[model samples]
Target: MSEHKDLNKLSAAGLLISLGIVYGDIGTSPLYTLRAIFNTVSEGGQTINPMMVLGALSCIIWTLTLQTTIKYVVITLRADNKGEGGIFSLYSLVRKKAKWLVIPAVIGGCAMLADGIITPSITVTTAIEGLQVKFTHMRVIPIVLLIITLLFVIQQFGTSLVGKLFGPIMLLWFATLGILGMAYVVQDLSILKALNPYYAAHLIITNPMALVILGGVFLCTTGAEALYSDLGHCGRNNIRVSWVFVKATLILNYLGQGVWLLQHPHYDLRLNPFFQIVPEPYLLFMVALSTIAAIIASQAMISGSFTLISEAVRLNLWPKVRINYPSNERGQIYVPSINWLLCAGCLLIVLIFKRSVNMEGAYGLAINMTFLATTILVAAYMISKKVPRYAIIIFVAVYGAIEFTFLVGNMTKFFHGGFVTVMIGAVLFSVMWGWYVARRIKSRFVKYVEVEDYFEIISELSEDESVAKYSSQLVYMTNANFKTEIESKIIYSILQKEPKRADIYWLVHVDVVDEPFTQDYKVTFLIPGKLVRIDFKLGFRVEQRVNLLYRKVIEELVKNGEVDIISKYTSLHKHKIAGDFRFILLEKHLSKFSKLSVYERSVMWWYYFVLKKLSLSEEKSFGLDSSYVEIEKVPLIFVSAEDIILNRLPA
Candidate 1:
């Protein structure tokens, strides 16, 4: 195991960039949380009581402190996967001993993705809703949809362009929050008394409506998962250090709102309380700034969704897709399909809810479920790593009580609007889980062929006059083991139809492992000319660059005197270089069988159909140039037991 490195090596500017990118979603919570809470009360048209306002503000502050600052910033961020963090990162850390926990991990990931969709819709719509304060009749839903549409459109270009500006923009946002908050704080200093935890505890235990209020208050900390998920982008030290300033600003703003509500208890703060704190003359200008800040928050989540999907693909928890890492920087990625899916979801949410306050009912549950899942996974991780069982049990008992309470409080709002987010998460989780299971089953059924089986045939082909004259090696890139049908096609084509002999046949298998770097490469040789199997065990953190690894293997072979180092080109490929290397690609097609159930055959057909359309052919999948590829397709009939024994064997 490699020693963990300190995060101080990254410069201050880099640290700030990391914080800006990672913390944007959470940092922008002040824009709508207070306003949403106020709207919930104001809908009744009754005067807001000073005590209720103060109690709610106190709950918001303590929640951020205990949940976001203490739990996530102090403890959760420490469970990093070589500096990466998320449900998947926690899964990797603990999956060895507690593999059963993967179900909940998948659930958490789906919930996070669902939150990704609704968050941007609510955050941006709320900011735009504030615009109605400046212009009484401005349409909110259309503008919100437009903004979300633009957000998705720009995702394909990647975030590196806009990410550079995130730090400065977020810094201004925090400063704006602090200044506006302090301005209100000066108006009524008495509200500062509500900062005590006793006020929150008193309200929860005494106030009859406190349970529902707790559900609303939980909104303020919805961005905590965003903080944990983005830890890898910004190191743990940078995020932890930055949280001090961010958390301070959040607390002051909530307290300032409390102060304002205490004095203006009967004043109807309709749209957004954060915007209300600024002076009348500056209110319009502040609304404009807040709208821009909200858009940036949405943009941050759009990028986050892309990163999560990319990680899912690498882990094989999701289907294979085109994953492009836009920047050389680790964790910077772009996924076109997911970007569009989120855009569609966000637009639909805005059109349906039409107002941020209505959307608030749907928000807290998804994030709460995410928090609960993380706590469960992290506890399992601590136990797996040899932490004392007693310590783990006690930690779980305390955190479990707190999280379960919040989950139930949030669950009370299920029919109130939580069903939308839950449904979205359920659909996504089903698709991902279904694909994961199908892949595993398909892998088990497919047979792998040994390299030794082809050696004798290849040796015989080498004796042919037509094959001996060709100066190229036949390299096949396949995921199938020795028994895969594609292997037989390569044999038939080379020995029967074309009969081209080559100096070497390289059968390569690339297994994507869940680590930063693979410990060793396993090489198996089946006597001189018959077969050779080389398994490249790559770490999860490592990029799959075929050419680099291929060169290293060749060098090792030469150093071991298996081939002449000076005559490598001729020895491996008969004589010529460059165009002389011919990569033979045998694609397998699974024919339909009546014996299998309709659903199973349909799924198999769909897999093959989708693979043919989206996945690269064997040549491209292997990273070979088009000019070097000689492709061949083979159809394999998979006869089900029912067809062979029951139907075909007549009585």
Candidate 2:
């Protein structure tokens, strides 16, 4: 829990960092949000009415107030897993409280990932396309593709260097938004009337096509979910304090855009409201700034995806992928497989859409679904904590209606490129669901043996002269949770298969807990100096490495005189030589002779396939050095095939 507390401090530095990381997606919305709305309202390339501008501004304001401020910053932020925030972190907290809660968790997680793909495509494309205003006939696609390719390629090297400049750049970006908006706001001060809620209600209630237009307006606050996801990075106090300045600047910019729209009612969609509001001489500079901001936003999304996949692997909802800690900074991870996959997806979206306006058709649909999923999980959590039922009901009803309306509005664009993102979400969800279910089925067949039944035999074996020594010390990785029990296959591997003899045998068990960044252990002596068991309780977010933890535990034991790891050889002991240690790792396979149902067979087949393709070797997964680690194959006999009738025959 102290891990999350570190991020909760309120300070000037924290606020600045929060500004850069938390607001990228939502902050850059002004670049294209209004243009998308105008395109939606008048399909025939006609000028948008001044009243529609007022209505659209009103909708954007209310949506931000209700959806972003009330639901996320105020309510959802309160649901923290020891200061860590995100759908997966929220899921870990409430999953034990309600069994079916995983459905919302998985859905929310997948939707957010799908949002990752479309967001970078649209944001980068919009920013790059700005150059088209001056350099007519210069192809935007090639430039956009180059920028995106470079963005993903740099992920492997980590972002700590470039990430430091993000805060100041974003601060300037917001300040620019405010100043530009204010300059235009004074030109037509009457545009401020959109601040009133009446115009928003009037537009949606009267306009026949308001629902379709609302879909495009939904993009204004799509990044609200990312704010909650990044809560742990900046802390609650820092985020809450920084949001005041962020929101104020955002509103001023929107008002400025509204004022500009009122004056130039006949402006083209290509002349985005965001850039048009800027001074004519600064257009090139603004375009450059927007591109940098968009890239920062893309970087945030990509990192978030890597974190989400890491958590999913720990929870058994996804396959294990290689996670690299490229920087010395804690929690900064790079997942190679996920990075390239996202790169491919982003490129596909850009090539298909060719421009930001077309990309808008697919953008908000996924994130709106994520918004609803977060609402459900947070409400479930509040109820589990015994918060007042009435308050929980109110929380659900208000956000539920707001998000549902957004979902409906987004559905208007379902066939018009919206299907692209939904299809991506479905694929991700299937992989997670399949992996999770298959793990549960495999766990049901695990068989454990009581340690008491073999304790005396193991003691005697240590003294036996007939058996050959495997090593001075033999260590095994086990799934057993209790000191008095171990996997049956371990007993078979020792007593029946090889008849291993050793001065000491170690049984190591790892338990992954719900907390983040927790790394603790307990030691038990099963047979005094002959055998021992070390139980490690690791948090889901912590790296699972037995070899490293094993060495630490050994060092502590030797210092305490609990066990001596000195060399067993007589001549080596006099020189104070360290004993040799070897580890045995088990890899389970579904047995061909087992009588499994068709469903079990199918799940296991896919499960092993996923593991082989996506994960590392058992030695690497355990962080064991290959030279000291030996791997053995074992069969998982869920149901023995008694149906296979065989009789004894003379040889």
Candidate 3:
């Protein structure tokens, strides 16, 4: 959606929409959070008791308070770029100020994506695991696999129909969580005792597996970033207002689950407290509701991944792949490569781990890395925005320690499938880093020259009737920032590669800016009617449709007396027909003859590999039609070879 969506309204409808899109990830966590904690404690050989339950409940309450409430909703939400908010949005704001900020942005982006894999695997498996509550011998893996596969397959069609149902369904989901949780909660009013901070502290200090339990507690807030990422949709007012109700329901449910566990100290750790708290008649109904909500949660995760990759491509942090907007829904996109890749990951985790309890170990850890990276970026952003230094210090110190402890606790999970998410993050980060570094290296070598020096030559060639006419109109996509500056290769291409003349020369430059939705252009008649320059200042998120935009610019120029577009041929000029325009695109290749360092060689090797495999050619990427385009290869000389040794004697 356009980041400028009007989400500031406090109306009930806004809140309901917020309930659907914004809260899906965090709202559905109750289905599996306690179950994961119990599993972790049981596997750690720790005794489960009322004290432990109270402590765990207290930890969940405070974590939601400190991590989700204060840090993200209150602090990070303030860092939105115009109306868009995400790592890339935040990075775009501060990246110009700090060149190195790209590192953390890529890290945060990749880690968030790695977390995407486990969110679906764990939440979907957990909801399906509820089925075993009715059929003890049911094989849930097959069921989970089916659900996961269908989710991916339907992505191509888009989710407009079912997506509309998400709000009412999630509203129902949260209401049910409150009602069921409150029922058990009233059974023992004393269960409210867990709300005290002492129990949470006691659990962490006295219990041996407290850190592991805390790791599980983290799952409850893993989707907290989604709340912020979706800020543009629901607006801060709607989200902040709705979060009050959502958080209350979530906390009550956790407390009620604690109450159930306290009463049944001998309860099997594998049995879900979420389902058990519901009345017998509603057990099947509860499973059905949980499954639907889990799917919505998974949908939010998948959609967020698409947005992330799309932004990464725009920001040059990741390679460009085909982006499909199935419907006209803003921000609703489908990337086949990413979609199928995530589907395979979810399926693999479901097949190998085979249970939500197992997937939980692989979750949270990668998200914590995301949390930490965002914190780092936020700190830098705060500094850049001129927030008070003292306030920034306090903000950083408090969240820093909390997230680091969360990180250390989760570090223990590396050997136990946590390595999966971490490894995925590392690999994804490397590919992005490789792509980014290669660009920086190339920037050091690409040649630029003053177009003023070639203007006389170009004018002379244009009128030289002895030279062949290349086309009525000639366009070249440029890297030059100023009208006077042009790439040296463009000069060579016209003067040496194959000399040609044209009546009018068009230099089109498209600038991808930091904003999310900028599309303005400037035109300068460098030589009045004979030569013109069009500089398009487009936002990074904008599609690079230079062909269509160029046509539009030409029409404007023709109407404004800036230029004439009638063909040079006398017959076409009488009919008022437009001249033919051909675009020349420069394609760079790493020269086999050039010398390079090991790092430089590796970077270029992977850069070209990624270009061929992952990215569209400039002609296609820039919205140029192949029929009217010409591709010319240029050597990328990072370090030119020294003088060659004389071989005259040998010859």
Candidate 4:
């Protein structure tokens, strides 16, 4: 079994890596968060009230403190699954406690994936919007689109080289944020009064647009979920320690922006406060640096999307998709289908929204669902750990109200592009929900029989001379968990289909465990040399390359003198040639003769015809060679049609 490295140990490199990977999204939030907040309240170039400024600033401070720092960085990080910390990873830990928990896991997974589309579009566009400060007439759309196209294009070649510079670039970016923010904060130390919670409460009670302001405020902590998702890449302690530095700079920058706002209460809403604070001499350089930072943030989100979908596929929450390892780096992966799809979605968002300000609503709405979902899973996790009842209730009550309020605020943008993200999340959720439920519906009818019932017959079939040899060793992939049992379809394929004869029969089962990197296999020799069953227990994050893994198991078995692979033929055996192995895959299809309710039929239609068509084929998904694999179509009759009347006409 492969062991996970201890990236959690506190060290300089670990902190640097955490800066690059864990903070990309939140680190870049300063790009547009305050801009969106002021724009919401200012309305039609009106003078912005001083209370709005101080209250909004106070809201931003505590939101980051409670939402990002306390809930995620401090508490949720404790729910790590063997050093992994995503909604799915958290769900995997508590799924057995309650089957209903899958609802939140799937919802959270789809919402985060949907967030990937807008994060790139908004961050890059907002950063490039800085160009307008120097060149008022510059067309930002074309430039933003070009940058995004280039970013997605490089995904296939791997980013290890470019990835190495991410830590340093982000480090510089955060430093720039702090410097520019401090330059303004010193001019008006009184703006620091916004840090008081009283201002936040005053705004909520008196401001009519409180919900709208909150929708904007939610953007600051959007990356908190991503912070937790990347837990495995950089351990918990690294994140915790780096977050202190990250949060300090973020607060300083936001405070600086507040001071700038206080100095000019009626400042032009067209200009972003984030860029306005920058000294004119460095505006262009700042714009260029921010664009690069935006790309890094986008890349991290895209890569995280691939990892999320990969885990979903292994856990059977999603249909199998082709996953490619473009680099030798341990966790780096590329999914061509998802990569291109995300690219197209991003381009579409740029074309429709046309400005970073227009995307704020969509971005906030999409990620708010993810925040709520994570809260649910984390609460369930605390419950599983047997935390005190009062603590659990307080945790849920406080964060639940916080996130739900954010959701309501985001909902205000439904007609104004929020629906864009909602619709995307819905489509993604349907696919995941359909895939999971359809599997349950199908599994309910799958037949399993005791393997012991057929051991004697399988042994005899291997020795039957009248039957033609299928292969020296014939293997069948089974879904049965216990070594004492096998899927009935596999038995039907072997004995009833063609009466296949072979020197040996092998049944292989794959069990995806909750751990992230487990890779252990158990081999049970039912009839030593004649019949065998191998169970491969893999972690959710582990790739299921059955062909390669099966071969490795055979090699180990042969080395231990538990099996013989030499050709059984008289001539080939003398030459010591290797035996041939063939794999049988029984593909299932919906049977027309089966009776199904309208809901089941719809789910089956989507799962089989839609999701199944979109997914990789069984042979390719399992990493099996086409030449050595055979697929037999099997009709899946969940409920057979009522006894047909006069079906036989005396034939």
Candidate 5:
């Protein structure tokens, strides 16, 4: 296998295009961040102090610079898995040494998923909200709904078509920010003084409502997780290079909003302050263009969510669902279940809130929790990896302090709106964690027999004239492990029913790794008797083509002197020495004996039933030829007291 590549290999031009597509979320925040901040302070047309607005704008600029730029781009991007970075990437890096931190990592990942839902809702809603400045009577909800519906509808087509336009459109979006902001900045150069950190410090320490303000301000950095998660897609250098332009444009636009606010203290630009800076005649066209831009931003997050969930499923951190790689491009995939789930959630959020401002109250919790979780994981990574102690201490202190403060600020909004986000995330995380635990328990109880024992049985059976005449080799495809319940069933079924065996016994186990590319076969020979066992670790990102791999494995075994190279395992062989394949499928049916709580049993049953319908067809999942493949279903019973209660409980 080739060594993993890094960001340095990409050309400068490729990096720029990658950045525009990957960093679109953080890049697009200027469209709504300033408007969100001012809306919080200027409730009901209340005249806000010019100094306060400047102070808030100053805080927004410095926060992006310090929290997003320095913290994420400079420090966080350095913590990557091969070249991938995300909550799971960081989790994989630190989980071995800092196992205790997995809880927080899981929580962070759950919150990031929640953020995925709310992002598109708020982004599209805010863009549509800008319509009021020009149309004055345009229906906002319908437009927002239409934009979101179209965003998801296009996801099935993959990103290649829209991806090319993402760079140039976002480039134009950032340029608009600069041009509009400069127009306002020239009117009052005094707004530049707010750039000093002291003003933000003063506002926080002196103002009683600073906590709420900070909570609102936290929305400005909501896309920081997107910056890290998309690292694999865009590469680290592309994101870093792109952020230079993205961040500068964001800061200038924010300062320009401050300049505009300072001049028009009584003006209620409740819809969107960013668009207010533009000339009135062009504001409608800007809204139309921005709605398109916002939809693109939302699309990027939706795509990123698909990739994250795909990785989660591969790592066994999340349950298996249907995953389709719509593009030959390395990381492009579409998960129908997740895509629809997010669309439904975003639609509900938009309908319930009816405005981006209401959704804003709920947005920061997921982002803050995700950031805090990442910091804790990063600190653990530093210590375990034997990085300099002083560096760990200093970095942790800086990041932890900011993270804690933001967590508290975000928590303040919990009952008001943040609770909704947390609840949704909790539901998802619980399902994933529950499934993981159940799988582990099932694995633990499985009976394990030595390969020597099975090989000895095969050796004895090979000598029997009746057994040897049936088939040349026995190939059992099983979902369970080599020594688990399925193995026993395979043995019993062969002896009691057919009463025949084959010349060779092949034990194969296939594991899906969370990489973009992987080899087809990894062979192991159990010694003394040289019992052949092989593991085929395939990449989840690759198509599951069993026949192709089987051919390669047969070739490899022949070269290794394990099998004859010339004998094809075709069904039409004249000597009737065709390879007999038995697929042992272990199906778990929940019963009163299963050891689950009443609630847990209900959840499991619900999952089981839903999965029965939604899961990929068994024939496809196994990559088997239906014409020749023989399948046997073996039922495994795992009973606990909870199952009894669930069965006895009234429906």
Candidate 6:
């Protein structure tokens, strides 16, 4: 808790760390944003339109102010889940407010993840493409692929070593951006007029391909969602403070690019303005620096992806996958499956879109969907906070109109490789939706009975010398939320399946709460020492390491004389030895002949065949020791046998 507080506290180091993690995506936007916009407005053999240039620069400036600055940093940052921010974190806070909100939450999360794949591809490709200015025959694809491969490969070992360099390096990178842009901006004070709203409005009204140009303009703020997603890593205050500097540099750079366009109206449109602004002597140094900065940006996105999936799993919106803490750094995790999958996706994207110019459309389209999803969720969050009705309407109206225009503009790129990311988002959303609904469908058939009903029988069986002793202590995981309730299948396993006796029976229930790092538990001794129930209230970010947590609970219980762990055997009790603990993990398999609707069947098919197959087993996921665990296969009967008709004569 102190560590979390430290993260939120305002300090110079905190601000620098925020710059390293939160601003990478947006900070590096000058690489392709202006280039993409210029390419869009000045296609073919025409000199760049002066009004279009001003309008694009104006659009870029205001977009950052409204979308990135006010909407995310000011308003949405306050909608954090215990210092955590992201689509899943936001949903966790407001999910109970509206059941249907999950649709948009999942949509937003999937879109952000899709953005992760393309971000690495586009950033590295654009940075490496700078080399082409000096060596026109250089191949950028292989170099980009090699850099990405090494980046993903290092995820397993962790980045703590090199992560320290990120802050100072990005500091230099942004400083360089400001210096380079400021140098050119001073030459033409007239370019400052592009920051005006009139130029932006004029361009929209005059340009026939306004949507297409807006698509290019939207690229300037593509990293806004990423900034929000990383709110937990660097606290809201740190991000807000860092953004002041980051945004100023970004605006200066764009304005500088605009100034260059005006001065060299007849220069080759193929060459990047960002590169053109730098002195000839410093181009190679700038290229090297940009490449390193691009890697930092990619690293941040990859880390964000891991955090997103981890939260989704805990929230039960995604399948359980293996998560490893490769370093002691706060919130640093490496997901092997996610790592490889992202690598493959990035490599494929690089191969398909060899030039950064070609990837602009896909990148804009993907993140635009994410922004729209985020807008819906932020509005929901505001409503939950009881913000004024008028305020909510105005908020919705303003961003809704702005983001909807961006969406329509991005749609113009659907054929130009935008479908790739859209398709990826669709697939990801299907997986999340399927996993969530499958759990709901399975829950419909689950039977819960009062634990009080079995108290007498369980106590009797514990002392029944005729029955063989199962173990000194036996534990079964239950899905019941109430202390008095236990799964009917668990009761059957205890008394009906085999009259197994034990000194004590334990039922553990894990409840994932909305807060990010909450860890609390309640112990209820239903039948003295014979029957016990432990309810764990863990936050969405906490791992359910039941075995270790249970041990800690028992230590506290024994300290307070709540329970005993001494062996029941006369020979071992005298030695002060602990009793044997055995866990029973009930694995549910869908019944072959169970009845279900087409939609239910399809959801189950996706859950079981695809998600479940890829996920870890319950014991491993819950951090249980396999040596002390036993698996019990249970058939999930959606439609019971009583529902079927049979002829009496046939029997």
Provide TM-scores for the models: 0.85, 0.95, 0.96, 0.97, 0.88, 0.98
What's model 3's overall lDDT? 0.86
Where in model 4 is the C-alpha error above 4 Å? 1-5, 44-46, 641-651
Q: What is candidate 3's lDDT per residue for 148-235, written digit by digit as tens?
A: 9999999999987778889999999999999989999998998898889999899889888877888888888999999778876778
Candidate 5, poorest ten consecutive residues by summed lDDT: 564-573
Off by over 4 Å in 2: 1-6, 44-47, 592-600, 641-651
Span of ten consecutive residues with least summed lDDT in model 3: 638-647
Instruction: Mark the 10 consecutive residues where model 1 has the least summed lDDT.
Output: 563-572
Q: What is the model-wide C-alpha lDDT for candidate 2?
A: 0.87
Q: Which stretches of candidate 3 lie over 4 Å from their true place?
A: 1-5, 592-596, 641-651
CA lDDT of every candidate: 0.72, 0.87, 0.86, 0.90, 0.72, 0.89
Judging by lDDT against the true structure, name the best candidate: 4
Better of 1 and 3 by lDDT: 3
Ranking by lDDT: 4, 6, 2, 3, 5, 1
Candidate 2 lDDT, tens digit per residue, 1-651? 555666887888898999899999999999888888887776744457777888889999888888888888888888887778899999998889877988889999999999899888999999988887778677899888889999999999988888889899999999998899999988888888899999999989988788887898899998998888898788888888877788888888998998887887877766778877878789899999999999999998998999899999888788777889999886699999999999999999999999898999999999888898898999888988899999999989988887888899999989989999999999898788778877788777788989889999999998887887788899999888788899999999888888988899999998878887789999999899998999999888888878899999999999999998888779999999988999998888767624567876777787777655666777877788999988888887765666568899999
| CA error at residue 458 for candidate 6, angstroms | 0.4
CA displacement after TM-score superposition, residue 163 of candidate 2 (Å): 1.6
Residue-level lDDT of model 4, residues 393-505, one tens digit each, is: 99999999999999999998888889999999999999999999999998887889998899889989988888889999998989998888888888999999889898989
> Model 3: clashing residue pairs?
1-330, 1-331
**Model 4 clash tally, residue pairs:** 0
Between the candidate structures 3 and 4, which one is better when assessed by TM-score? Answer: 4
Collision pairs in model 4 = none
Which clashing pairs does model 6 show? none
How are the candidates ranked when ordered by TM-score, highest leading?
Answer: 6, 4, 3, 2, 5, 1
Give me the displacement of residue 100 in model 6, in angstroms.
0.6
The root-mean-square deviation over C-alpha atoms between each candidate and the true structure, in angstroms, is 4.4, 2.3, 2.1, 1.8, 5.1, 1.5
Residue 543 accuracy (lDDT) in model 2:
85
